[model samples]
Target: MLMDAFVDILRTIIWPLAIVWVSYIFRNELRGLLNRLSLFKYKDLEAKFEKELLEVEKEAKEAEKLLDRSLPHIADNEQEKIEQLLRIAGISPRAAIMEAWREVECALNDVAKQEGIRVKGLVGNSLSADKLAQIRGIPRENTDIYTRLKYLRNQAAHVPDYVIEEREARRYVQLAIHLAGVFRLKPNE
Candidate 1:
């Protein structure tokens, strides 16, 4: 009877003990798997971001075609700024995306000022694509693309855990450049 009791105890303890031992032994592997899973999730997020940006670009291009005119060319200095932003993307994708969006913001503020619209706060601090679009009578389609770009920029800037890929960052910079060029055009032009 004692032997049978001992065997029953062993059976109950063995599985729990083995589980604890295996967990301890494979802790590092388990941690690595968790990290990889996190990275995989972020990869999926990055892919979705890229797809959304692509759709915005396509919409912008279609709008341009429908308007039967291309966005006016920005000045050489503006082109230089865009090139600098592209180079920055190679080093820090997040910074590049942020700076590229800043260019668009700056352009919007400048246009507002040129239109005699009173900018309420510090130069670029208070301006937004939406506000500028509403006040300046910008086309609805153009405003939509600008808003979408701003949304994507916020995703890159606000998501602490997200790592922006360099290629995607460059694409964002290109889109910002296009929007900035559009904003920089004089009303008469």
Candidate 2:
């Protein structure tokens, strides 16, 4: 009777123990697989982000063309800064995008300062692109594009695990440069 009881107990516990042992043995591999799956799952989100960026880029190009007059040349120093950001994109795309957006913010802050708007600190206050646009009499379409760029920047900033491709980062930096140029224009220009 004891022998039969022991056999029954072994059968009940054996499969569960084997599964636990196997899981422990391949834990690191399983973790890596799950991480890859997480990235794959977010691929749709990445695609949508890229599509929005492309639309904003197109809008920025159209707006630039509509200006008719040439944009004021971006200074050599500014060009160097942009190039540095592009190089950074190769190492860390998220950091490059964030820095590019900071360039846009700095340009907006400069405009705000030009208009006698108080800028509080080094990084400056939270003066938005739309507010600066309205104050500077920028066209509504251009303002919309700037707002969308800010929106994309916010997404990149907030989503910790969001992956930005280097090319996408480059596109974002280019669009930011264009918008910053527009904001730097004289109020009547």
Cα RMSD to the true fold for all candidates: 6.0, 6.5
lDDT of 2 at 69: 53
Per-residue lDDT over 39-122 for candidate 2, one digit per residue giving the tens place of the 0 to 100 score? 565687689889999899788778777664567778999899989999998989888988988887788878878888776753
Cα TM-score per model: 0.71, 0.72
Off by over 4 Å in 1: 1-40, 122-131, 134-137
Task: Put down candidate 1 lDDT per residue, 1-189, tens digits, no spaces.
Answer: 999999999999999999999989999998888876775588788888989988998988876665434566667987898889999999999999999988888888788787788777524432366566555545557778877888888888776667688999999999888877776655445
The collision pairs in model 1 are none
The lDDT for every candidate, in the order shown, is 0.79, 0.80
**Cα deviation of 86, candidate 1, in Å:** 0.4
